[model samples]
Target chain A: MAVTDEAIEKIKGMIVSGALRPGDRLPKESELASELGLSRNSLREAVRALSLIRILDVRQGDGTYVTSLDPQLLLEAMSFVVDFHRDDTVLEFLAVRRILEPAATAMAASRISEQQIDALSAQLDKLGDSPSVEELVACDLDFHRGIVQSSGNSVLCSLLDGLSGPTTRARIWRGLTQEDAVSRTLHEHRAILAALRDRDGEAARSWATVHIASVEQWLRSTL
Target chain B: MAVTDEAIEKIKGMIVSGALRPGDRLPKESELASELGLSRNSLREAVRALSLIRILDVRQGDGTYVTSLDPQLLLEAMSFVVDFHRDDTVLEFLAVRRILEPAATAMAASRISEQQIDALSAQLDKLGDSPSVEELVACDLDFHRGIVQSSGNSVLCSLLDGLSGPTTRARIWRGLTQEDAVSRTLHEHRAILAALRDRDGEAARSWATVHIASVEQWLRSTL
Candidate 1:
């Protein structure tokens, strides 16, 4: 395991140092193994490990190449890890979202276009005054995602996207068990959309913090 | 690839749904493969991939088991992905740190103990009036890490820790080329520590933001 880890670091160092670039094809297996001073077996294992996280592209017949190294591509692996979080950790995760989502929403407000605002409004209308837990959760995810996506920072988008999985479950559970859940959520979404429409970054940031903090409050009492 | 991905998702689903739990040993390979309706080959591949991300523990003699799923273990994969980021992406990554790190430092200010403060002060003093770029970089990493660690949120700690990697390189380059790099950094650290010693979350947050933003400014101009 130590040897495999070392090989992984060596390959990663190559990328960091610009020796192996995004989309660059790796050397022939045996030759590369000798160059890195590792056995062929260790090199193979390292490549397989890197491929698992979408860091390396392993084509069926062609050759393995470094990935585009996009933030979205790299951070996608976080969703897998987020899935393993325990119920208690969900709150810790929510705390993070509370900080990031609002900041992202504020960024979006300064830059979000008219068309995107209408799309968000349309998403809320689709939910109507009352919706099922699934509908509410789906629409809520969409609304928040729309705003964060508009922030135009892919790293922030990816991190929030990954955290959204467990968070979605928490929202669903909140909607089902709480009183006035539907109305409160819709009201909050409306408030957030209003802030965005007015291009009020502070309002958007404040409302977003309020929105997630309410959920966090509920999670705390429930726990 | 599809089959392997499916296998990975199935296993992940088991963990998410509480069917398989942290520290629980998976069933034998043959039985577990059949249970998931997957070929042994695909299951093996899935396990290897999960192991790479520290989601599973594979013993040499014993069977594989679900790991503790601690955020630290899981988020360690992020450092690997972060290593592949290019120069341009480092700014995007820094933008994230600018948000999270300040919030994290504020949290630390309220809760960080005298002992922790002393340790942090000692770390800063160890650099003396003059230190090499490498030593400055190491101390800089340690200073920010100390504050974030004291925040006592492992998920936040993990994210910031992963981000510090690429940021370290940026700092090294800045220190090498820019004037007063060492003194400016040490001064910022002192301000942050003073705020922490005073237990002022807002001040800590403000100073921390100013500290990182300075670097961001330099990065923007450099780029």
Candidate 2:
């Protein structure tokens, strides 16, 4: 194996074998490179690879440390991949989100606290009938994100959050805004929240299905 | 921005903007570094990061290049993340798979070629009642992957395949080897294939549900 790859695997093995827990500090670059029998340059390559996957947090001037290794953290690398998705696949990606998010929201319905629902409701209120597409997009992202996180599956929540990335949505909403989109989006959001507020998983599923399908249809037409 | 991250984004932009395509060789490290106004060391760091996620192929002695950028290629990183899923969440992953794979199979039924089906059958024949755990696992992986790929949606097929990685099955099948597992798994494959042959999407979904759920049940029991 190449020295750089050997270094990557050795570090992965340390984590896998429980010798290096999340949040643990890595040895300084020079010392660790010598231990792994690799040049410092090669060892730095391994660290860079891990950091991209959110396995390591390399602070400037500060020492490098293992990240929390949370599912959300690891899957964040997915957004970069998703960004490069073939243009035609955005709808297919949305189809996936439609399946996952509804199921997730249904899961959230049973567990979302009263206060959490209030917070979600407040999120919708924070947006206006006339915010720019950008603010609306950000508001929309966080509102749904709050509900998904309420489901308490960090993996599901993060995957949903990452897939609902800005670049994809900015394009979608840019088109939607031209079609009397604002009220329509807000209306769907209200319906979704109402279903959840009633603690109705089935209703939430139905509403989310319609809600997601509307945007999906819009995206499909644009495509 | 850090020189390394700047390089990462610059390379990604090249792909996104059509300056780079799958299989396109990157500029020589020295050349790229000079162009991007970064040190060679920093550019190497950027290449290393992209390579880990299968975004770049860096063969020894050969120059680094953009990968095929296929969804399957991209989601392979998810396999490593699957390794670290919290114990019970494995079931959640399975639940998501149960949703994805059957839909994938239904899609495949329409698009799958005669030769592919013949090959699938041929693969099934290889897995007799007495195959080793490793062979059965390999067969199982190939069988499902074939169906997913047949869907012709690269993103969906690859993402589902990434979720249904071999390590998880090897871990489960190692334990489920009791109770005629070899035959049972093969039989399930036959049933699913039959549904595909009949072009019965509902039946295909049903068969896969039972097929995967049986494994899920066994896994749950083991857990």
Q: Which candidate achieves the best DockQ against the true structure? A: 1
Instruction: Candidate 2: give the clashing pairs.
Output: none
Interface root mean square deviation per prediction: 2.0, 1.8
Scored against the true structure, residue A159 in model 1 reaches a CA lDDT of: 92
Taken over the whole model, the C-alpha lDDT of each candidate is 0.84, 0.83
Q: Flag clash pairs in model 1.
A: none
Tens digit of lDDT per residue, candidate 2, span A1-223?
A: 7889888888988886778888899999999998989888999999999888888899879899988887777778788778887667788788778777888889889999999888878888987667888898888888888888877777778788878877787778887766366788788888988898899999998888888898988777777
User: What TM-score results for chain B in every one of the models?
Assistant: 0.89, 0.90
Residue B206 error, candidate 2, Å: 2.2
Cα miss at A41, model 2 (Å)? 0.8
Model 1: CA > 4 A from native: A1-7, A25-45, A59-63, A166-171, A174-179, B1-3, B27-43, B61-63, B166-179
Mind giving the per-residue lDDT tens digits that candidate 1 earns over A39-113? 876677678778888889988678889999899998987887787888778888888998899999999999999
Position B180, candidate 2: lDDT: 67
List the DockQ of the predictions in order: 0.59, 0.57
